[model samples]
Target chain A: MFRLILVAALACVITSKDVLAQEVRITPDTASFSVEVNGKLITIERNQDTNHKITNEFTKTSRPCPPFCIHPISAAPGVTTVGELEVIDFIETSVAKGNGLLIDSRLPEWFAKGTIPGAVNVPFATLEPSNPYRDQILQALGGVQSGAGWSFAAARDLTLFCNGPWCDQSPRAIRNLVDAGYPADKIRYYRGGMQLWLLLGLTVESPNA
Target chain B: MYRIVVLIAGFLIAVSGMLFLQGGQRDPADFALAEDIVIEDVAQMSARTSQAPATDLSGLTSAVRASLSPETVAAPEEADDMAAMTSGVLAGLGAPAPAPGGDDAMQQATAAVLASLNGATAPTNPAPQSLEAIISQSMQAGESDAYIDALLNEAVTSGSVQVPEALMTVDGRVDTRTLIAAIVQQSMGSADAAEIQAIAAEANAGTTPRAPAVQEVAGERLYTVEQGDSLAYIALIFYKDSGQFERIFEANRDVIASPDKIRVGQQLRIPG
Candidate 1:
């Protein structure tokens, strides 16, 4: 009887199937990926432009990969995409409350031209597109800083903007974030670029000042 | 006796074989990474310690360089301490806490807002436990509409709760808990009710300047794209993504056509 039971158990174990096949998903699912030599990671969205090249090159700014490193990524179905207006409102309120940074998805030169005040610029080109640099960028952006002085961490309520609604800059940058494995809800894109700001008569400054 | 021993041995052999097969089929790659885990914890330590502002690397460039070389990553003990320092710094600078008396004020203010709109306590379903826990968990999950009815029910079930007819607004369209939270947080530490009134007036008016404070942005470089500037390639040069490039492109689109097509030296606006 015991032998029969053991055989039955083995058969059940072999036949009971629930696991599913995995696929290669990009880090910043919405952007492109470039791997750097130092095992650093860098992600670039589709819109921003700059001429300053330091090191490394990639086919596209983002791409999907079979989840590597030490862990697995799982997701439940039926997640919803939150709207841009809600994110903008949250950022506006958060900024008023002194919460986090609103990153401008422009090049250093463009950043010099004009941008929302207190925003940081990280042109996606200079990062490694692999296991490490993705985290490094987060650390560098006052996202996750260290030392006796002040540090920053990127995991916050961030609202990103570039040109305008038809403009793909902010969306591309947001894609980088999404691909970098950040949840879609955490990122907010402002589709209107400087045009909307000018139209609204908010504020503008020349890059040379 | 031999037959019995053979049977026992066969059982053990079969179990061991099964275990081996199971282990073979189990791929370690199929694991989930909760946000906090790092890929190379030791490598992370070396990177942080090297970047530490206090570390003296001036006179000891060679030593610093050697330590940075992949082979000599920080020792286990040193890495642990450095990692701790890194985490401490992160925690210290991350998520600011809600202001003093903020929760109560938020509740009251939301109640007031709801009263103005609804005339009764905005109905909520009875939640399993606490509102605070639910909210916190929602924030962690990025959002949660789960058990909202329960939460409302619980709030209504609490005794002596004043339910005014005026609080019940037409269409049941009430202000959200988030709006009240924002309002109450802004009112914290105020010395005057008049100031609170004024602030509320501004909030209600919605004409308050929504943009962040302006800063100096002059003398920044200009990179106008001539026709055929691929967003990906441009992002590589800028160390940002093509999305950021579009920010530049759209900001200056009046001078250029599509982000895909731009003339050289278009005086593209670059933020300072």
Candidate 2:
């Protein structure tokens, strides 16, 4: 019986390895830099997918990428977090403060079902290669370390949170700010994220509800 | 019999396990209710823009005639004459309403037209006017908490609810707080019960306007919009559906005052 168990465990390990070998990896596990926009040190986050090749193949071949293969960027240097938190704590704090921003890194349905009160929707997939709103976000946080719309020289603080520690939204967001040169001190990350927040018994308002 | 029952149970468990494994390899959408971008829809938006001149001419001719006098062209003879004069009249209007330049702009204009035509159009732009060029276009008209709460309560009472969803890409770096506030404000601003009813009815029918769902970057959690970001392309990249740019603007209302005005380096809060 013990031998059988060992064999099964070995098979599971082999299966896991096989799955790992199937993914493509992107460089810069997390990109951090501060672009000097207007004059504030705006922080930014970038989560790299080391396994892009495998994912592409799977997607193209009409196969699903293995679960947990898509890992979210969680933390980096210069993130100031509000609570001993989970993602939900950041959201609750944001709501309690009645001023901070709560970001939902989950898809639309998750957002619609229930989200941290007053949270906005921004997805990680669209971060790079430029979109029109990048500068606007930096301006709100204060100034990009080096990009345009580094407008707003004032050092306004912001709290960043995502689905959970497993979620890459907060990390990538932080990286984007840091890369833009936003001051790290002004930015806080809620590491516990939404998974924790949901677990913490905080109320989530669904757009649909 | 007992042995056979145990064997059957074991077989069932094995089948369930296989199913789970198969499902585990399925797309995220299979396991969870997530947003998906429809590439065809995005392609369609761009196609529509390219075809804008043709559409605009037809629309303008009708609009001008409609505004002038229904009696003038209500008859078949007048209608024939009107059709004959349509091109000349439209040419006089000029430029045929430019295609909003990009997908985001187009989406913004479309939303505005829809709202206005439906009645209950708020100030065309809600953000402080100075920043109009840099802000994301208003997603929904602003709604007050009191009004939203009342609406929600009413929906609950009616045993139906209209929940709004973010259908646009999360690529833009707009303020999340500002976006939600904007949406609430817009919802609250919808003072016309009839228009509100229109939205509610559509939502309840499970026919929330079709838009694309956002996809995640491999191994990354965020993407910042740099200089040269256009709404259409962004929608294509993230949501795979460009028609949902208004939804994106609505989600990021704080930093984005106008969809056409995003500056480089803005940090957008990305939804999954």
Candidate 3:
């Protein structure tokens, strides 16, 4: 899988036919990147069709506020806000290397429709302390069980996102994690979530499908 | 002497069953009573068969006798009805469901008894269903094209169902698509109509009022759009990979909302 990723990364280095016509680059230097996800080679590149605008339900702009209100640029004191590139970079590095998970904090139904490729769904509700399986999930994320709560001394890095900047699912998830004594610095908040990712025409996969 | 007595009993039971069915068909009151009577007969026969371990005929025999019980007397009537209607439609649909062991012994026994009694005892086959009737019914039932294809093959060979002259390929094989189209004449059996129109309006819905228009480009492998031309079918024609239809759809998304809605006579780019 690693070799496949390396080969894909090399393949992307070669100029594409579209690039010769009109280049759309992820960064000044890099055109695309590849990562191995569940033994499948997931090559993350912007959609080549410039005219391809998403036709899915994610196009809603005027959702009523309390749930869809614009979130803070920063969720908490130590939680860092990351963009699509940072999220992509984190996926290629931390997630692929098994040191972290890029989490889709939306509910499972929303996650089923389409998600940022290489993201794993851990819905915000499941992270609440009220859930009996909360500690089990924390343990899965490399948290050690202590007598009273949990020890995040070895907690895995988690980058969480939901529907977009207006969505609070990820923020609530972060709060849940922080309340359970998970280290805030270990959690990275991707404020763009799915909407901006689709707007930019980055690859979205139906992992649940 | 024992054999003669059993045969005599069988004939009497069959005659009574015919009378009951004729009467039941006349009176609407007997229909629900008939179903209940059939259920009770199955229960008794099922218990008898489990104890006896004899042939399904033995269970069927007892069930026929049990049908004459004061309450139901509907088993033999049901059997008489089953004998009269043995078309592939009812042969496939009308039987009681079979249950595995530990679920319901009566259900299994009922299905077994019916299977034995229902099959045409002699080689003299009844007139088969008409081709149009078979195709429309099977399609309405949501059976696969392959299933309908197989059924058509059997019907055509047996000289029962004739594939219409128009649906016959140049090589003389039945084209199931065109055949289904003959039944659903409006949208040519395209799924796009089913997608847009309300399900209640589905049978005669031609939601796409415009005829499929094709754009021909020079120096391309041009294929004319026939009725029922889907992107997947076109991809199969060009690349032999139906999944590659997505590529054509991406190029043509400006006109159609879905790949399925692609009209006839549009030249698709064959990406090398």
Candidate 4:
């Protein structure tokens, strides 16, 4: 009787797996993932509909080039440029573990439009030396202040992304971070950013939500 | 017969008066309008931030302009008047336009304006969690009317939001046309002149601007290893990334035979 029951359970599991195959996934090996954002559980997944075409403002192929110029794969020396899968891994491993941050380094209005799940709004402008709260932000990022300079003994690994390859906000942010003595090796740039993230039908979340 | 003659005479006199009124002197009081003229420059600067009726007016003007062909375009004077009206409507918004310049300049201007707009609340919050935030979030999530209605309903039921009776129809439905104005007014927190005055106010009631105070400590840096100190910790203190411990280990080969072995109170030179 126990053998018969085991066989039946195995059949049931197989049928369920077959049903799940019809849905979209983060990758072939991964279906959906959840991240803890601001103490809330947000599930990040691709749109299930295969026919889902992007109709938003991000669909425009042409943007005026002076500001929206395409950026290279490399952000700067020692800063590792990453893709969407790595970003997911970073969010899960570092951000979920509280050892890292995914910085959406765009202006607040742009950030308000939409962003990656588990990301925090740290506008690129605020990271500059001009902003009065720059040190406070540094401190919040685990920089210890002494008379000499900031000690990043416990600094979080930050992965920054903006509005994709055409967007320079993240690159500008990476430069500023390096200028402020943030380790380039610790900083990762998601060059694909929002544009590619959306193009691939990956999830986009709002900070307010 | 006398009545007919009188009516004809009255008609002729009225025609003469109409012609006279076109080019003759008139009372200035006849053309009186509101004294507190909202500056078009202020309106233009505010631009997209306002949800006032003026925004719709401006939107309509632009829409009209967009829909019309150049051949069918209105007179230049009429177009100018429309532009002026659009500018006037724009003043009701809270945004401050940046000086015209290159792309970087424009982006910086946007950043500056956003920073100032956000300053109305706690300095720590990057964006205001107002009705606009709700709509923005909704747009990001799903811009369907049903979704927005559900969101607004949730907000109302949660008691964090209060829609005025004027904003509601007899059946308690939100009036979509006036809702934009309500959102803007809620975010602004007060009437028009008060907002303009607040912006015009001599930049007080904010933190005094200060230059970047980061003193350059870039000379040949040195550190005294404390108890339980490792090359990694020292590297972290100096370079902000513990992965760079190798740089230190390579530099201090004479003092320490191995990268792992660092005794307490050992002096080491940290490279800049």
Instruction: Give the per-residue Cα lDDT of candidate 4 at B202.
Output: 16
TM-score of chain B of 2: 0.21
Whichever of 1 and 4 has more lDDT, that candidate is: 4
What are the per-residue Cα lDDT tens digits for candidate 1 across B36-61? 33555556667766753432434233
| lDDT by residue (tens digit), candidate 1, A1-209 | 56765775565455343111111222224233332211223222222222122232111221111110111111111122233334334434554344544556543334455664434444322221321334455543335434532233345566666544433345545655665555555555555554454443333443234
- DockQ of candidate 2 compared with the true complex: 0.01
Candidate 4 is graded, for docking, as incorrect
Q: Give the candidate number with the greatest TM-score.
A: 4
Candidate 4, superposed: residue stretches over 4 Å from native: A1-21, B1-272
Pick out the ten consecutive residues of candidate 2 chain B with the lowest summed lDDT. B133-142
Report lDDT (Cα) of residue A26, candidate 2: 20
Compute the lDDT of residue B90 as modeled in candidate 2: 33
Candidate-wise lDDT, in order: 0.38, 0.43, 0.59, 0.60
Clashes of each: 98, 105, 2, 2
| Separate DockQ for every predicted complex | 0.01, 0.01, 0.00, 0.01
Q: Report the TM-score of chain B alone for all candidates.
A: 0.19, 0.21, 0.27, 0.21
Q: Model 4, range A50-125, lDDT digits (tens) per residue?
A: 6577897677654443345689998988999999999999998998887888888875556667999878777676
lDDT of 2 by residue, A88-187 (tens): 3443444334334455544332344466554554443222223354544444434544543353356555566665654445666677666666667667
In candidate 4, list every pair of residues with a backbone clash.
B43-B90, B43-B91
lDDT of 4 by residue, B1-272 (tens): 67655655565565455545433223444335222233554565477346344335455445334323343244332332233222222221222322222233323333443443232211322332466676654433224444455667577667677654323332344433224323434456654533322322211123232221223345655566654344543443355433466787777778876665666567777766
True contacts kept of 1: 0.00
